[model samples]
Target: MNQVNVFLRQRKDHRRWVALFLALACVVAYATLDRLKYNGQALNHKQMALVCTAHGLVAHEHNDDCYDEDGELRCPLPELELHEHDDSCYEEMAALVCNELESDGHIHDASCYERVRDEEPSCGIENDTHEHSDACYGWHEELICDIPEGEGAHHHGLGCYEIQMALACGLPEITEEHVHTDDCFVEIDMTPDEVEELVEERGPRRTPSWPPCAARTRWSIPPS
Candidate 1:
């Protein structure tokens, strides 16, 4: 090759080496900084991202009161043990996290969070059943049982009625056997008319029943 061409080639090769070395130096610096931040020595993007990912990107403020403190996320309150009611709160946080991610161009990860939020019953519907069913039933029975007085309150199986009531009241489900003090308690899920037919066939509660209201409560007086 000509002398000028060779000299130019050498310069180009030198520039390429210089560029490669600079890139390597930058990578080493970034890696070192990342390591330091993760070890709690510094606050860096890598550490922040990793922490956020570990926490599922969802910042639940209701239960934990997670807030930004000195450029870092910190909880002002102590972590709470999740209860049935916390489902809604978790969903809310998940929503916030997904929204934040989406706004920041983290579309794929945000979509994953959205899916998770959607699958979780965070509307308090599932927890609603557990809580209400547990409380009202607690006053009446040990186990999750049907309401003792059948037909009086139609549409729900007496058991279903009791379960519904307990759930409405936010009581958690229990396994205690459900029993009533009344002498004659029926277990059936029938309409008002069906209940009337059943009661008429079985006869009314025993006279002067041990439970004061048993006779009056069990007798289905036809609605005028």
Candidate 2:
């Protein structure tokens, strides 16, 4: 190679090595700083992420928040004991921690468990209060038993109400044991007949916690 070309090539190689070394150095520095931040008792977001990563959890930008493979929020530690409605993280709990931290507007329910924000908030703590059925849907209800087979498809053996509500599904293969709750309902300016027609046309849809009303407010929100 010509001298100039050889010189340029060497310079390019040198620059590449410098960049690689700098990147490695930055990583090391970051790791050292993160470790140093954890003085003794607890961890911040970055340190929590490292610990969570070690335990097969995805660390998020939010402080001490992590997710499991299924995208559900997870506890950071594997050994922190919690009681009363139980901690959502179970390990490094969020409810009581948020209280000590005094994060604006955060509150624990009578059970001492933090209330779940919205059904789809980025990081709502799981209360682990509700039991799951084989398959659950609308009305926030659960079916402990599966829908009965061909012989008694219309009848859900027990813990289900068939008289007040009919199986919403039309397919013969469907066996339903859904129980509708009356705890809460949204009101709209429509007659019963109109609502029924609208429901028939729109089909079945579980209500989402629209507008994240459950989110703890650091500041008051004006209603739309």
Which model scores highest in lDDT? 2
Query: What is candidate 2's local distance difference test score?
Result: 0.36
Please, what is the whole-model Cα lDDT of each candidate in the order they appear?
Answer: 0.34, 0.36
Pairs with backbone N, CA or C atoms under 3 Å apart (clashes), candidate 2? none
Q: Candidate 1: RMSD over Cα atoms? A: 40.3
What is the Cα-based TM-score of model 1? 0.20
The TM-score leader among the candidates is: 1
Residue 34, model 1: Cα distance from true site in angstroms: 0.6
What tens-digit string does per-residue lDDT give for candidate 1 at 90-118? 21111111111112222223223221122
RMSD of each: 40.3, 39.3
The residue-by-residue lDDT of candidate 2 on 75-187, one tens digit each, is 33332222222123122111211222112242333443333323433333346885544333223333333333232223222222112212222212212222212321222
lDDT of 1 at 155: 33
